[model samples]
Target: MRDRRGQGAEPDAARPTERAPSVRSEGAPAPPERAEAVLPEGVEAPPAADLAALFLLLANSALFHLGEGPDAMGEAAPVDFAQAQFSIDLLRLLREKTEGHRSPEERRLLDGIL
Candidate 1:
């Protein structure tokens, strides 16, 4: 009698007839479809550290202006200013590092911003 696989196929003696381990047996669940995060035209996604720097800059600026006067808040004014400056500096550094490599579209975007 022929095996289940039919002609030329021999039953593997090492494998159980009922449930042989399959190399292709239903692999890990198919990867879920994901939508790419669409950034605005001409802009590339910033590195994590650069984004974090931007966040810190904005957050510090908000904190600084929320109060009436610099002296109104304790030591937060200067500290916030320093934090914001540092973040801005970091952002500038990142831009400088990538300056020459930007595409024409990127240059236009940066020009618009500046």
Candidate 2:
């Protein structure tokens, strides 16, 4: 390799090093905090963190399998009857299992999906 010293490249010892900000006082690594979420432009954020979100997520999966949702290429996925049925069944199970515990709006959202 050609000499890099003459090209203004610093030796490793001359470069300043940075300590990672997340270390603990005892020198063991600190537990990570939940990082802020970032999303691509035009993509919707995930649903609110609740049962409604679960319901919506499962419902979305069902729709995706049914070819009603976008694929990785942003086009509608091909129909997958078995997978679609499985997703629907999962949604139904969640609905039944959470019967009385669901909020009014959640019940309506799930019911609408079904």
TM-score of each: 0.29, 0.57
Local accuracy by lDDT, each model: 0.54, 0.84
Candidate 1 wrong stretches, greater than 4 Å: 1-79, 110-114
lDDT of 1 at 33: 75
Estimate candidate 2's alpha-carbon lDDT, on a 0 to 1 scale.
0.84
Q: Candidate 2, residues 26-85: lDDT per residue as tens digits? A: 867667987868999998986568988887788888788888878999986999989889
With a 3 Å backbone cut-off (N, CA, C), the pairs that clash in candidate 1 are none
Maximum-TM-score candidate: 2
Q: Please give the RMSD to the true structure for each candidate, in Å.
A: 15.3, 10.0
In candidate 1, what are the lDDT values of residues 4-67, reduced to their tens digit?
5643355466554686445544766665876668899999986555433454454445455544
Off by over 4 Å in 2: 1-46
RMSD of 1: 15.3
Which one is best on lDDT? 2
